[model samples]
Target: MPSSSTQRNPWRYLRDADVLHAAVVTLLAVVLSAGIVWLGYVVHVWRIARRAPTTLRGRWVVLVFGRQLVADAPGADYRGRLARALALLREKTAGRVLLLGGRSGGARSEAEAGHAWLQGQGLPADAHVELEQESVDSLENLRHARGLLQGGDRAEVLPPVALLTSRYHLARCLLLARRLGFDGHAVAAEEGLPRTPRYLALLLMEATYLMWIDLGMRWARLIGHRRMAARIS
Candidate 1:
């Protein structure tokens, strides 16, 4: 049986109050940290959006990122992006185009499908067009494209690049392009479908991806610095 003194102890109450206060402070700290991270992410996205170039000029290569095709045909989003790319290709006569995407849901790769579509659209025979069908994602697309550009005769002179993607995806594409060391601009295509819950979900997913990439790059730099320091020491 517990004593009444023990049950009514003011010191016990004080101790519990202290613990509750500490817990609340810790929770608040975590929330504040999360808020700060979220704010930073928003600012990063905003900056990328602001920096997305409106005009593409010079000896630029149009990089059309691939989307999933159904029944070997480009879906509405992909069609919209392809249409924009076609328009750009027609307008920018001197600029070449590169279709970037991987095989999905069929034997034909996205890049291959894009090229075929453009040919079907009666693109000029002399227009410089390239296909990078091996990439699995946006990062891989840029990396592979860089390799293609820097390989062989073009190694000495890498041309500037312009990305054509959906409006929501353009910022992340530009971010990836910059990380891959390309003088890049972005041309955002109009969203083919109306804004739905899926669109918001995709935007959130992109934001998460951007955060992941930023963290990965920072980690790589830190690791590289440590390795260099170790070698020097």
Candidate 2:
């Protein structure tokens, strides 16, 4: 027979084991969360690489927007890339090109520079290249351009508008285009572009904008239903 002193408390042993097991599980969960984030980022880049080019041809208008352009510029990478995108659009779609941006600090707005460069590349003067100089951001660019495409008629069906921008900017710009009721596709201009600090800036800005809008939109919807019920009551 076992002595009384030799008897063990099973509940205490179970509790101690549970605490240690919980700590180990928590550490593993943290590592798994980090791994999943990293894997998601990798997958996003891979998908972008696969779908960045526009394959459809003929008269599919391509719209490109970006920052100002400077002559004798050292790092005018965005504008340079914008120019390439414009040229590619001309070649691929054989459609009119509309560019939008603002002139800041004596540097030519991207719209102006793109028009000049496109014309210099032998694009037509009157209708082939149009410029919208008032927009400061991608959403504004698309909204104002969408108005032009619709030609002041709310009932007009939007054309297959295609957006051309840097690789990192395509996804967010596409979302903004859809939000503004643009029935269009987006393509990243992936040719002949240098490394861009603007890419990281755009990504951070987009993530912040999306996070705020998502939370705010959800709260608004919830409150909206409550207000509607109150009014009905």
Candidate 3:
């Protein structure tokens, strides 16, 4: 014999197979939808990595985003980026460089390490170069680099510049650069899109990071979290 209050609110009779099953179905739908959206972004990243480049004519500054150092030396990928930047310098097309990265799992900062490697390769002392040794991640890399470019005799607005990094990394770098108001194009460290298992793994990891960042930004903006949104803006 239940009280009238319980009987009137018939939802009190809800069982696991009743309301709970519907809840589970709804949850699955949401999860599936999110997965589809994430996969689409992954495809977009892949396309950016594989796109062929045309001749870059204008003189531009090249921003070599840093990778972590290994044994306090530039890793293979990091050296690739350095080599590409040096090629631009030798081609006499780009005249300036800003190496962006902080110390991570290494005694020396990535910028310092990369600069040392470039000098060892015989990069002249008189080349216009800048080191951004304080950024720890891609977003911060672009943000701090933005400040450096605009804070002095650099430029009121960015001049044409190249974002130099690994092909797998270039997608996220370009995304952050555009969000931070950079005027640039992607310059791959490697010449062709890699299909090796190792490179595929790199692509997957980069895609996940990109999806996380964009989804977080959208959610923050939706909730009117202006400060969170501005962190990436």
Candidate 4:
């Protein structure tokens, strides 16, 4: 009589080397596909920055923030590009700029830097360049800037505003702008530095911060909505 002890277990066979190799390959494929999709989305956002609207009407304000101007300085190529873009905007909008941001180093605030840049370009003192000197990040920049604008009589009477930031940042910035009750368009400054290790590091940091800023914006909107509803009721 033949013993049945030699019968192979089906479960054990499934865990063999070839089967394991197949499973690993399948997982790698899925991961690679997901990476591709994410990259495509990033590219699309870049395009949005490059092609934002350039016009503002009688009732809207043109807001420009991020990276202060310095056309010639150390590790300041992005600031230079943004400055040039803002200069062009000033020409187009005829001095309707609402600059945001504060100092990066402990020396100055983002709003102060922005003010200095526009003033250097000969923007009048009354040219509508609002500042949020206390804001250290994008979320604070936008939130605080919006509050400053809304607190003014002109903002109450004018139409919604248009926000401008670097092109790659347009996606998240636009999201925050809208969430904060800005019923206006967002323009990408479309500025960049040469793709180098340092530049890439800056880009990565900016992207990571965008995610955190979005979280802050979510909470801001939730609270804003509740307050509005409470007032109505």
Structural similarity to truth (TM-score) of each candidate: 0.72, 0.64, 0.82, 0.58
Per-model C-alpha RMSD:
16.4, 19.3, 14.2, 18.0
State the weakest 10-residue window (summed lDDT) of model 2.
Answer: 1-10
Taking the tens digit of each residue's C-alpha lDDT, what string does model 2 give over 68-141? Answer: 44562313546555555556655656376677665533345556666666566666344466777666666668
1-233 in candidate 3: lDDT tens per residue?
A: 21223112225425524234334443454488977866777788899889835225677888999888899899999999998888787776668899998876567788899999999998966678799888777877888888888886444887667888898988898878887778779888888998999999899888876776666566666778676567676
What's the C-alpha lDDT at position 101 in model 2? 64
Kindly report which residue stretches of model 3 are placed more than 4 angstroms away from their true locations once superposed.
1-30, 52-55, 152-155
RMSD of 1: 16.4
Ordered from best to worst TM-score, the candidate numbers read 3, 1, 2, 4
Query: Using lDDT as the measure, which candidate wins?
Result: 3
Q: Over the stretch 64-181, how does candidate 4's per-residue lDDT look in tens digits?
A: 6655434322124335434644555555563455666555543555455656655666765445556655554555666766667667543463346676665556666666666566
lDDT of 2: 0.57
**Best-fitting candidate, scored by TM-score:** 3
**Pairing residues by index, what is the TM-score of model 1?**
0.72
Supply candidate 2's per-residue lDDT for 166. 69
What is the Cα-based TM-score of model 4? Answer: 0.58
The candidates, ranked best first by lDDT, are: 3, 1, 2, 4
Candidate 1 has its poorest 10 consecutive residues by lDDT at: 1-10
* Candidate 1 off by > 4 Å: 1-32, 46-55, 152-157, 191-195, 223-233
